[model samples]
Target chain A: MNSVAGTGLARAVGRLRGSGRSAIGRWFVIAVPYFWLALFFLVPFLIVLKIAFSNIQLSMPPVEPIVTWAGDKVFQLRLHFSNFTFVFGDDLYRAAFLNSLQVAGISTLFALLIGYPMAYGIARAPGTWRNILFLLVVLPFFTSFLLRVYAWMGLLGRNGPINGVLLKLGIVAEPLQLLQTDFAVYLGMVYSYLPFMVLPLYTAIEKLDLTLLEAAADLGCRPTKAFFKITLPLTKEGVFAGCLLVFIPAVGEYVIPALLGGPDTLMIGRVVWDEFFGNRDWPVASALAIVLLVILAGFVLLLQKVQAREKEAA
Target chain B: MTGRRSFFVLSAMVFGFAFLYLPILSMIVYSFNASRLVTVWDSAHSPTLAWYVELFHNDQVLDAARLSFRIAAVNATGAVILGTLAAFALERYTRFRGRTLFGLLTTAPMVLPEVITGLSLLLLFVALDQAVGWPSGRDATTITIAHMTFSLAYVVVVVQSRLATVDRSLEEAAMDLGARPWKVFFVITLPLIAPAIASGWVLAFILSWDDIVITSFVSGPGSTTLPQLVFSKVRLGVSPDINALATILVLIVSVGVAILGVYMMRRDRRRARDAQAAFAVIP
Candidate 1:
């Protein structure tokens, strides 16, 4: 089936290149999406980069253009490295960057710790139950993400259910300060992104050959040892994929930290928001965003390289 | 040992699912609270549908929901069309010039932070509006366009994966029988991958509907989406009306997903049976 498809696709490609009308059709298919993405996605990034080098102004658009035209001729060109330098030199921006990394990294770790077990359990369940379990995992994902976070707010507020339960059980003298803190932020992150982690992990673990574990057990290996030596190593790609899925967005998560986090909880996402909207500093916001894009792009490239190597190895 | 392992697995599953569903469950419960305060539950008062009533009547909420639905519907359709084309180009063509760049452009949005994407797009709109008198100001068009950009990435990934697993012989056999390439795609490939496209549409729709960050960034005065409205409201404080709205959204989404799931499951069963019957004939 696969080989036939390969050859068929190859032949189609050949015909596409050789024939004029079909070639135009193929080009049209490619060109439409290509142009849309180039204009909307790629050009926007360049615009961001360009704006990052411009100086903030109190004018209509709130930024001084890097290039100016006087009567269709070049008037003057001014590029500001000040925005980049300011972001680098400021402790506020630096702390926000570090804090975002820390929050995202910790939340991702917790998600993995929780998600791995659930995914493994789902994979090992009776075949009929596996689909239902997978559905349940994804069901929450379809619900509004903002609503889910709001649900968290209700559950963790000072007068909320968690505090009520804790107070009733005499766990503490007073209601625990669960809301508007890093703890709440982390909880929100883990809750919201857990599905992201589990979906990939379940896909990986479900595809595992159980007979390999049986073989190890027949060879007198303990279940724990067999799991460590066999299952974990095999599902490493899922772990990586799940981690990347959670970590990338969590790093720039604004809603969670804004709603759940205290004033002290500084994430680069919220910082960028304030810079753009609150402070009306488009250039600085653009600068901060460019820095984030650079980091994420590097990580994405690295992930792609790793996946390619794995494909080659396979 | 087996008993112990099963126990562990069972316990983990219970705890994990509880953690996942409890917040949503609580929200649903509290949405019924007769009191205005969301966190307070008093048995003295009877549970009321007052908040739901208010939710139906609120012009702001109703308007926002209407706008969000319109944008999501349009964005989902656009994303699916653009995404399927991109997916086909990548999977079938395989060696087009600048394919690497095309691949990156389509896929990067999948993982790019919403903050960055939103900020960059907003900047682009502002720049473009200034440079050329187009997109005059941020509105539903801009929001839909931004939503489509990110949603397109997701649709591409979903459709491309399905395309990867599709049997090539189906198209090949059709071509051998003298079907045009376009006819083969529409009659053969399209029907085969129809399930993927359907799910892609749903995913895009949901993503666009639930998006707050990007919409908030690009939306001008009259283009606030439901999520953006909810976010702003929740930020100020939780209102029972928002809870009622959330409950309704949950119900709608749950029903939608359940329908899709059952449909997919039935289709899978029929496909599997057909495949088995075909194999039996060959034998």
Candidate 2:
């Protein structure tokens, strides 16, 4: 749907068409949101970058200015590499970064494995059923995320039903410690973000031109091969969108880790949270955040470039 | 289509829905538990609503709900306006300079971690208060702004997707009929995209209502929201009161969404019938 860069002729047409009756109205459409985002979103990241470069201090704001007027009109910039150095050098921070990547990657994989079939099913279902199934998938999202995670705690707890059934059926000698484990954290992530994975996949699959698949079948392609050749390639956008939607935020997810994860499952999100609120180390926290942002930014750019290349090829 | 619903797909649907809902069902059951311990089945007493009664009287929760309701309403309204503008710009102003950067800025909040967004925004507020003395002190206003910023991204995503799918030819027809650009939008495009705008507003409101991560950082003294209160209560362990709260929220949302879903389905059917009647297709 995002053509990215249209033909020059098309772009000109778009530009000409965009000129409404009044120029002020056209400008207002773009300017209001443009200024709002630049102020609220872009400016905050710049502030984070500025804070990351400054030394930690004990104050209300908790960081000194990176650039200050020193002496008489001689501007001095004080930059500190200590925060970045400490964050990168520390084993704790290092482990958290690695763990966050590993956990998020694996969770995205599971979410895909589960979400793909469900999305395909829903998208391909009969018309009335399709609407109902889509609503079912999204209904949980209206509920509180925190409570939903909390629901996992109850369902997987020692005294919860999973254990209750297993123990009652004499499947185990004792109740398993399900809560506050890596298993719980992964379960929480997959459960919470499953809708994110399913929604896009459903949209993409629903948009699939079935004639292509029928044409492939008429050409003697097997059902499985037809799916792999036509459906998979055509739905790449949805897959990419779904994976990005799941993976990016999952890396910096604090609630799941803090609630469901064990001490060993130290994600970068929790580390940043602890540094800021626990130790009151704003500089280190900002530095950690910047490092995480850089990693995420790289991933985003690479994914988009790869997708664009594919789009161009097709 | 019937043949398409293979056993594999059916099982996936069953298992997926089961996995999604069993925990919620457990919460509902526990909320009615006659026992204080959430995980335990006070089969004798849990079939009671004592916890629900207790919470309805709790002033802290009630006050937090009131404040959160106000913030969510404000955030939703502001976010819808901003998001509609952003979405229209992205879809219609296809050749604007720096459109890529504008898209990135709008979508980045959706991709960025709440911790980072919260921290960066909190830092911005701190810096602003210190430098300009505008916010003076972090409070509901700051929290509302934070919610607006974060939720607007969702609104943009929702509204933009809908806008991209809208038939521009309808607007063009209006324009050709002596309608101005704004008038064309108001008469044609807005009605077509009303559902998307409504969903976007609901989503923004829900995001604000359920937020704890960002709200924790931006909110100041005496500005605790419902989710924050729930988090503190649930962090220790399972509690029946929280379970009851979950039950109530789920019930309210289920009722609201079900009604909305049915109403939409009925509306669509009626429209289809009207179209058929206009053409005298059946006769």
Candidate 3:
């Protein structure tokens, strides 16, 4: 009896030590991720904001201003909101911003239309085949993204295989000018982002109970009606999440437009790139960066609201 | 059974895969084409391995390829280590406050636009140079750091999921048997999460390998990575050499994937066999 009590006491002490160790470990965990983000992410945004509000004379340090503000004394180093006007006032910048929105909007729509069916198919696939389907969907991302786009270039080039085959088959009298166009930009963006759209949708669809669909079916709904009433509603979270994932990045995609888009297809990301590297306008670039962050932040809040509503509805 | 639904699904699946794969397939086939023009085929003309041969001999391509591989290896290793530790700290401890905030913070880098990420990294580099004179200018070191910044998020998620499923009793039993904390972790926990770490490493490597956006921001004149090289080339014009280079990259990646798949299959079989042995030994 005494030995058993001793064992119990030892166990209790062990539990106490474990809990104490875990408490310390937890703080370490919390600190590490927090520190990383603060140093890298939050600090970067803060830096962008600071730069956005500062004067951008080439010789002046990007961070510091020549003058300091003291109450009524206007300082060169002080915050300026003119950068916003610079962005909004420029007809080119406004056009690029609007073009970015349209391209992202359309590409996201196409990705959803294409990816939804693929995700649904994967979710409904046999368990043994599900992984293979998932891998197939994911495989394109593993390859060099540049090369993938280049491959599309090869296919879409006026004199490339797509045109050659079409001409040979007598489908069209002239070769389609597919490359270096807005159409090519849309194709590249949608293709590259399709996997991102599908994966999230798959996860959401996979979690859905088949009984709900069956119940809808048993309640005198046709297959299409049942899908609209049950399946679509059930996977709305994934659709929203996937759309957000695709749209946000697509809005900021510079590479696709830089390679595949025409001169007419100016995007905000490409414009920002030009500001920093080409234009050497650091303050304007920083202002653009700040605008992007605010927009993204808004988008994320919208996502969160949708997610919360989804949870409450559930 | 909805026949129409099944047919529509099947048609979509096949066409989608075809669209995804056909361009890749053509690229591979054209890599062996003897002619300079990739589109037109001359059946009578003999196929040559000259493009692959030229790919190995091209000085610029070789240098870029070497630089890319070195950066990827370094980033992958660093990300796996740092990310696995973060995962361990998150999973093994429960007393941490604001875990959800930490989780969101960790994932922020993943969702940030490449344009912004590159711009931020460039800004950080400028600030660091003015402050400490380290990473004197944008170079390979900066590139690797940028790659790790984003890739580490994915590694942590993969590792954390695996860690969450681990049975804690095993670690407790090891500690109860008088093992040190580190000893218990090494002996009881490390093996359990090894697969996750391996997967994470491979994923990180791929991300680092394929990264062009952030790398483009920080790469110096001569330090362009392979993807950056390809991007510059594609922007200028499509050359047959670029196609050759792409084919070789595809070959390497495809082989790596096949090897990983085979290894996973063999490991699964070995695990099944081991389980069978355990069952057979049971009374």
lDDT (Cα) of model 3: 0.83
True contacts kept of each: 0.83, 0.81, 0.49
Number of the top candidate by DockQ?
Answer: 1
List, in order, the clash count of every candidate structure.
1, 4, 0
Off by over 4 Å in 2: A1-21, A215-221, B1-5, B95-97, B164-189, B267-283
Q: Which segments of candidate 3 are over 4 A away from where they belong?
A: A1-34, A60-77, B42-46, B94-101, B259-283
Question: For residues A134-230, what per-residue lDDT tens digits would candidate 3 score against the true structure?
Answer: 7778778788788888888878887888899899999999999899899999999988889889999999999999998788788878999888888
| Predicted structure with the largest lDDT when compared to the true one | 1
Worst 10 residues of 2 chain A by lDDT: A1-10
* lDDT tens readout by residue for model 2, A1-314: 34645576686776676664367897899999999888788898889888889987787677788899888979999889988998889999999999999999999999999999999999988866887888889899788999999999888888888999999999998999999999999999999999999999999999999999889878988877887899998999999999999999999999999989887779999999999999998889999999999999999999989988998887
Q: Write the per-residue lDDT of candidate 2 for residues B10-106, one digit (tens) a residue.
A: 8998999898888899899888888776788877654898998999999999999999999999999999999999999998889888899999888
Predicted candidate 1: what Cα RMSD to the true structure?
Answer: 5.4
lDDT of model 2 at position B45: 55
List of chain A TM-scores, every candidate: 0.90, 0.89, 0.87
TM-score of 2: 0.91
Regions more than 4 Å wrong, model 1: A1-18, A70-75, A303-314, B263-283
Estimated TM-score for each candidate: 0.93, 0.91, 0.89
Every model's Cα RMSD, please? 5.4, 6.8, 4.2
DockQ by candidate, in order: 0.74, 0.62, 0.49
Backbone clash pairs for candidate 3 read none
Candidate 3, residue B251: Cα displacement in angstroms equals 2.6
Query: Cα lDDT for residue B105, model 1?
Result: 93
